[model samples]
Target: MEQRHKDLLRENRVFLIDNLIMKNFIDHVAELLTANMEDTIMSNATNHEQVGCFLNILERRGKGAYQKFIEALTDAECDHVRSHLEQLEDEDCVDGYDDIDGPIRQETGNDDVDLHVSDWMKTDLSEEQRQTPISERAMAFVAREAVGVMEVGKLMGFTEGRLRQFQASSPIPSSQISTMFSAWRSQKGKQATVENFVRLMRDAEVDEQHLKNVITREYPPGDAMA
Candidate 1:
């Protein structure tokens, strides 16, 4: 989760610093955070600094926290960054953005920038290996690696109708994955082991061998069944 946080901070710092990180967006994030961001950061920081500070705090919270922060940004009409995440694709070079090209930005005037917003998802375990029974990290990994609603649902034994409900209720795959994991754990009870969940992921073709390693070997002060 730390790396994802860093990448998001980097992305926002690079592209969003001037564009999305403004007073209106920061204020909206603060409102959404309620008490999460504390009074001091909200009251005493610049828009950019506040965002960094909030994310720094969230880095210790969990992926869900960062997700909510992104949602708050969306609520504030920062949809430009949202779309980049929505369809993890290489968008057409944003014609004429010249600043710091390669991975973050381009020069300007006559320059172009390629936006592969999917880069933040390169790492599987972004947070310190937590011992949550439901394995928040695993769910988040699947949410990032898995594709398509019905495909994942069917592979995990969710009926099309029920999967539709997840799609309806959760705006993003991360939330949908969490909701589905809740449903899965609720239904499966103590049977929802890390191995079982990993099976579902493999069946759905998420291809997370590294995550498998983490779950089976390195990560297990807690797995879903622990």
Candidate 2:
């Protein structure tokens, strides 16, 4: 998307989120935008997170998609969003970025995200809001809300053999998930972040329901969405 569009989306994100939550607009708008969002992503995500996904998808789909998206918003009586898109600056950005929108987003518009650890698991998210290594509070929220220990471990960079090894060794473990998290944190070192962790999970081709539940984590009340 143009930087103007990105800025528009960034500024009016809260209103659009509310609009999506209150109305039957998600599927309709997704159809218009050609995003084809998964059931898990739609069902388990919060209104705020859903809008994030929506905006990201819209941006990713680029020119062909944004017109449909804007038209849909206009149809939905989403004045805040419609007005912003319609009134965007004629000048386009060379790099096409918005400073406030630089967080490591959880939702993705890519294809074929694989599992297993890699140096590619670099983490740089929400520096505009929080640090990359995930603040303790954010980690706590992820650790608490997280389900599906084994899959999450894979997203966190664990291999199938290693998970089985742990299971075999610990036989009747009290908290396999917590233990997995500790290992992930230790391995990721400074890169262990809520954005990286959640994005990696959702970005995977698995499309597990767990990823949706993840980015919905509550940070401080009255965040940008609130």
Candidate 3:
């Protein structure tokens, strides 16, 4: 089996059985598959091969088949799923995770200054929130605050020019950025630099909570999604 399939099995084993919310998500996916298959048999059949790869992993876990999987769900399980789904849906609506309908915050403005490090530290933001992409201004600030763009890029195993391109056009992966940050900070007598870097990130509106979490070596909640 593919590593991705193995990972799915591992995640499903950990989350899907005991977690009603996950179970409901799987059920919803199954429902969507059924509906799509009803509409276009051949298309859905092709898709089913991909899904079948996932289901086969579950079957290996002693679930037998999809119908049996549905039959196995208890009333209490269904109730818990519905309750959790409703709560999540409500939160999603308020947060606009699906569709953010607002003006993008400018790089240098009062809006940028609004999200202070102290305010972020007080709230229990999820890993997803912390992992949100850093802005170019924030990346530039971090690069400046650290040893330098070239040094930081070397630490990240990327060329200085490539790192600059990433800062200008895209955010580096949070884990990679975090790892490089930590490694850069670990050099002897760099504690003050690290502190200054954190402040610079806060000033740049770079979601300093994640920087704090990384500097403190806090383990990600759950398995550090992506």
Candidate 4:
């Protein structure tokens, strides 16, 4: 199989099985590796053959193949597999696997980690809440509005691209984008307007094409249905 397919299989295996199942699979792989460990790594040709054989074994075993393989292995062999998996998990954690969410986040509206809401909120008040100028408030509010749009986009199955596109075209100024988004959201069941969106982006000096790309990621293109 292609490397991409192999990668996909690994991901599927990891996500579909819980810790116990994973342990069983690891045990099986360990047993296979141990049987040929002496020569498996010493010779590249043997390593390829062994890998193919291992994959064959796994395929024939089906969903519980790993567990079954483990059941047949000696206790010592099983320990080796367990140790390997522990090491893999530790490596994955230390490598910052959690940061992968930077591409597509689950918390669209809330910037807890990815969006950083605390920083955005700072713009909410000026020297004395004198209601900083509508222009600046409007710009600050864009972040809030973007949050809501992002949340809605996520609910609708939109991507990052689509969300940015919608934000770009809103008639609301960047300063008041948040309020505009809030107003649109309060409308209940009605989708946000796009005509006004175009007007706003034009005012903000945002590139129309660039916004389209952003929205493409956040929502679906051509159709904002997400």
Q: What ordering of candidates by lDDT runs from best to worst?
A: 1, 2, 3, 4
Question: In angstroms, how far off is 121's CA in candidate 4?
Answer: 54
- The digit string of per-residue lDDT tens for model 1 on 38-139 reads 564567457767656655544434324456666876788878876664333223224322222223332233232111111212233223332224465656
lDDT of 4 by residue, 32-59 (tens): 3322332333343543444444443343
Pitting candidate 2 against candidate 3, the one with the higher TM-score is 2
Clashes in model 2: which pairs?
A: none
- lDDT string for model 2 (13-128, tens) is 77667666523566556442321243434755576776667665555432335567767776777767567545553322334433322222324312323332221222211333
Best by lDDT: 1
* Candidate 3, pairs of clashing residues: none
TM-score of each: 0.37, 0.35, 0.22, 0.20
Q: Give the true-structure RMSD of model 2.
A: 14.1
Off by over 4 Å in 1: 1-134, 213-226
Query: Global lDDT of each model?
Result: 0.53, 0.49, 0.40, 0.38
Position 23, candidate 2: lDDT:
32
- The CA root-mean-square deviation of candidate 3, after full C-alpha superposition on the true structure, stands at 18.2
- Per-residue lDDT of candidate 3, residues 1-226 (tens digit): 2223233344455334355343223444342222323233333344434344334433322112333444434433565544443455456556643332212323344555445554543354454434443333344333322322333445345667665654554233333444445443443232324334555444332324445656334423443465
